[model samples]
Target: NREPQLELLKNFQKELTNYKENLEKVEDVDSYKKDVSFPKICKTNDDKRKHLAELFEKELRDKFREHSPTKTIYTRTNQI
Candidate 1:
């Protein structure tokens, strides 16, 4: 039983190493492109996304506030 457990751990480590190596080998260009574009897209959709997120967070906070004993505790916490 211990033998199999050890083998599984060894295999997991090997796979993790291989994955990390492969991940490191990936070109940085794609990441650079994604980083550059993602912000632009986010900016473009900022108004809508922000509005929706605020609405959702407000609704969630209200619902949780209703269920929880403390009312003011949740309101002061920083939300997204």
Candidate 2:
């Protein structure tokens, strides 16, 4: 119970830090979109959102898919 939750927390923090770092790199605001540069801020934010979704898929969603819904373990008890 705590183990998986703790692991998830760690993974989330790591991914969030990575995401923030990537965001910093793209903060110049003039490079995210060329022809769409008029939508500069929006484009950068959209890119951040997309990248965050990928991180969710890679870090959380993939693991979430492994356990069978009918056989999920809750609490520290194995019987449930």
Candidate 3:
């Protein structure tokens, strides 16, 4: 129901942020090739993206926990 919808929203947000960050880094690399000596913008972008991904994952996990703890909670079976 709402659980899946919320999850999708969270994922969308995460991907959107990543895309934005990457685009910015690409532009920076192209524009500031001499001014900014970062060796490789792609590398920096990848590192940033990794950190962002981790942060986003934690945030989404926490949100899911608060909103739908049942999503991850496993139950034991009891036979009569």
Candidate 4:
């Protein structure tokens, strides 16, 4: 009968409510945005590319250098 379907819907609603409550309890929702600080002035396309490259290199070094010292790190940029 429809009784099983009704019960399933009720359970789904309860779980959705619990999920919303947990999401609202999160304090640092935008904390990821605060982690990276980008340069304010990128006058030309080359400047922007250089800044992004430096940022990528710094992130890679910070994350993987300790784990793999012997591994070589390489970065490539696409030509426009």
What lDDT does model 4 reach? 0.48
| Candidates' C-alpha lDDT | 0.48, 0.53, 0.55, 0.48
- Model 1 lDDT per residue over 1-80, tens place: 35654565565556555644554445542352342333333443433344334444555546556555554566566452
Error in Å for residue 72 of model 3: 8.8
TM-score winner, 1 or 2:
2
Q: Which stretches of candidate 1 lie over 4 Å from their true place?
A: 28-80
Estimate the TM-score for candidate 4. 0.36
Model 1 global lDDT (CA atoms, 0 to 1): 0.48
Q: In model 1, what are the clashing residue pairs, if there are any?
A: none
Winner on lDDT (2 vs 4): 2
- Estimated TM-score for each candidate: 0.35, 0.37, 0.38, 0.36
Minimum summed lDDT over a 10-residue window in model 1 is located at: 32-41
Q: Assess candidate 2 and give its TM-score to the true structure.
A: 0.37
Error of 2 at 38 (Å): 14
- Model 2 lDDT per residue over 1-80, tens place: 46775676577667767766665667553455343324234455656556544544565544643543422453224444
Error of 4 at 65 (Å): 47
Give the C-alpha miss distance for residue 62 in model 3, angstroms. Answer: 0.8
RMSD of each: 15.0, 8.4, 9.2, 17.1
Please give the distance, in angstroms, between residue 44's alpha carbon in candidate 1 and its true position after superposition: 22
Lowest summed lDDT window (length 10), candidate 3: 71-80
